[model samples]
Target: MRDVCVIGLGLIGGSLLRAAAASGRTVWGATVSEVDADAASRGGYDVTTDAEAALQRAASADAIVVIAVPLPAVENLLRQVAQHASHCLLTDVVSVKGPMLDAVRRRAPYTRYVGGHPMAGTSRSGWLAGDTMLFRDAAWVVGVEEETDLTAWAEVTRLVLDVGAHAVPLPADSHDETVARISHLPHLFAAILASVGAQGGPLAMSLAAGSFRDGTRVAGSSPDLVRAMTEGNRDALLPIVDDALGRLGAARGSLASTGGLAATINAGHEGALALEATRDAARSGVRIDLTAADAREGLVALGERGGRITGLDGAVALGEVS
Candidate 1:
């Protein structure tokens, strides 16, 4: 990217700014709060609360504008960006994709918009909680549609690679559905688990072990952020929530039979083992060297052949043939 502008200096945005700066990119940031702007400046980036002015100053067709704010603010920010930086490649780091994609497609019709969600974050919020390694080795989903600009998509893939993330391409609706199952549903369960534990009083809270703490950790995320994500993707999330309830009901019924509970536990163990195997396979993928253009082409060719793209070394990995 020639120039990168990140709007909203929260945890994800701050981390992006830091990573971009470290990579020697001409990075700029914009935030609604003066305090956040100050924080971004302190972190060694040119930042301002005036988003439009910042965009205008950094205006270039090669610039990539990242919308890093909450779902509620995405529409307005996108519209502003569309007006000011129409030629730039636009993307986001929000948790939900469907709503964002719709807003961008409608409001920024003239702009090249790519929907993005980095599958890496903590319960922590704000710039102080940001870390340069937040997206390192993480899965970053980039939403593509018939209207998606190829050059812009390539720019986003490069950004993902630069930030040390594995770029996975998926349609917006598919992205929403998948995240509802893996991300949103987990957050819902975590919040429920945390709430249930709270009702068990001080002794129960004190007795919480590694599993309990680890499972409920995401429940500590900002309530507003959680609420927005859950609500914005309600269409996708509701069915997943219903499926989870059905599974829970089945587990409850299984408690009455002699081997039923054990069967449920065994199923969970099998699932965990399967996940570990997948991770190990990904890590063991064969590395290959090629030029940037050839590497991109190799990734497409490998993906078409049912191979995963694990990582990049300027020359990308074609991954283990499955």
Candidate 2:
């Protein structure tokens, strides 16, 4: 990426600014807050509150513009970027991809737009919460559409690598569906648990343990941000919520049956193990493909090929034997 401009210097945006500056690149940042602009300036980046001005300053065919704002602000910023810096490769760090992709496609039809979501950040907001190493080793989803320019995609992936993140290429729809299950659903569950516990009175709050605190940590996230994410992707999230409710109902039914609760707990434990194993395999740069008809044979074949079977998720098994 050549000259890169980050619009909205919140946690993700601030972190991006820090990373880009560290990489010795020409980086500019824009935020509405004077405090954030000062912070970005202090961090060795040219900062401004006027996003269009920043884009205009950094405008180039090789320049990259990263929109790091929340979902609600994405469309407008995209439109501004398209109007001000049409030649630059545009991307965003919004959590929900489907809507953002559609908006980009609509507003910036001529600009090369790559939808991005850095799988990083804490329950924190604004530039003050920024960590230079926040995205280190994190999975940064790069949404690859059919019309995505390969050169622009490479520029985005290069930026991902420059920021010490792994670029996981995924279709926008797939990215939304996957994050709905793994990200949005958990946030909703955390909010629900926190809300219920809060309503249980002071005694319940006092009696809460590490599990409760840790599990509901995300509930402390910015309410507006959470609302935007959940509401923006409600279509994808609803089905996951329904599936979760169905599973919960089954577990409740099992609690009244012989060994049902134990089986449920055991299943969860196995699932956690599998997830961890798959994570490790991914970290080790290993990929495994499995067939349901001969999963045993597949495992044997993997092992023979010097690949190790680490985990199984539904019909698929993954490992890093090599």
Candidate 3:
């Protein structure tokens, strides 16, 4: 689109507005905050605090209105857009897909709306964290349905490219499942791990080093953001979190056996190796085709690299050789 209206003026909205502007598109930012409105205007976005005004601006310029509000506010915001911005194409930068897409479908049936989540951010929130290149090289998930128009979808993809992100098309259900496994689950575990470790006594915390710090970094995020995501996508997220806990329990139960320590160590090594492989796949822009044999080889390599192999079948069973 040649013009874009970004609602919310938070980190994601502000960043997209700036990025779109940099791409030579006419961009405007709408927020409830007067200070942020003035700042965005000064920063070169055609700024307004009024939703109607934003819609009027979008109607004249081939604008795609992006709702960058939190998950809880997305529905009402979409309603506002539908009533005032009937001519503008609609999308969002919210983290959850099921709730967002469902809300848009119910509230704005006539609008060409898409649900999107650009998987890039820092702990920082609000207008101050806006960075023009925040989405660079990141994957932006676009949720679509059978009713979605091809032309609207193509324009959404182009908007993602304009912001330096690669668009990954997914149905709302698939997007919810994938995000729950990768994003929501991690944040939940991170917060839980940090809390448990800190409660173990001050001295135990003093000894926590790189691994602990790195693992718990996401615990520092805005609790409201985390809550919104976990609550909004609870149907998909609950099962994933339960499965993770099951795996953790399995490891803990195995730890009480004669070779429990070795088994636990093997599991840790296997996990690390799997993560390395995943990162390698991402960096190479290829999807890894995992097989039972490949997993066995990875476990064998892990044991050879000083991992304690609990049994001869450990490599085959764990599938980590790193």
Backbone clash count for every predicted candidate, in the order shown: 0, 2, 9
Candidate 2 Cα misplacement greater than 4 A, ranges: 256-259, 282-322
Highest TM-score: which candidate?
1
Quality of model 1 by C-alpha lDDT: 0.79
lDDT of 1 by residue, 74-169 (tens): 889877888888777788999888888788778887777888888889899888888888889887776656666545666777788787877766
Cα lDDT, model 2, residue 73: 90
Candidate with more favorable, higher TM-score: 1 or 3: 1
Alpha-carbon shift of residue 8 in model 1 (angstroms)? 0.9
The full ranking of all candidates by TM-score, starting with the best, is 1, 2, 3
Model 2: lDDT equals 0.79
Q: Which of the two, 2 or 3, has more lDDT?
A: 2
Compose the digit string of candidate 2's lDDT tens values, residues 35-60: 99987778667889998898887685
CA lDDT, every prediction? 0.79, 0.79, 0.74
Candidate 1 displacement at residue 21 in angstroms: 1.1
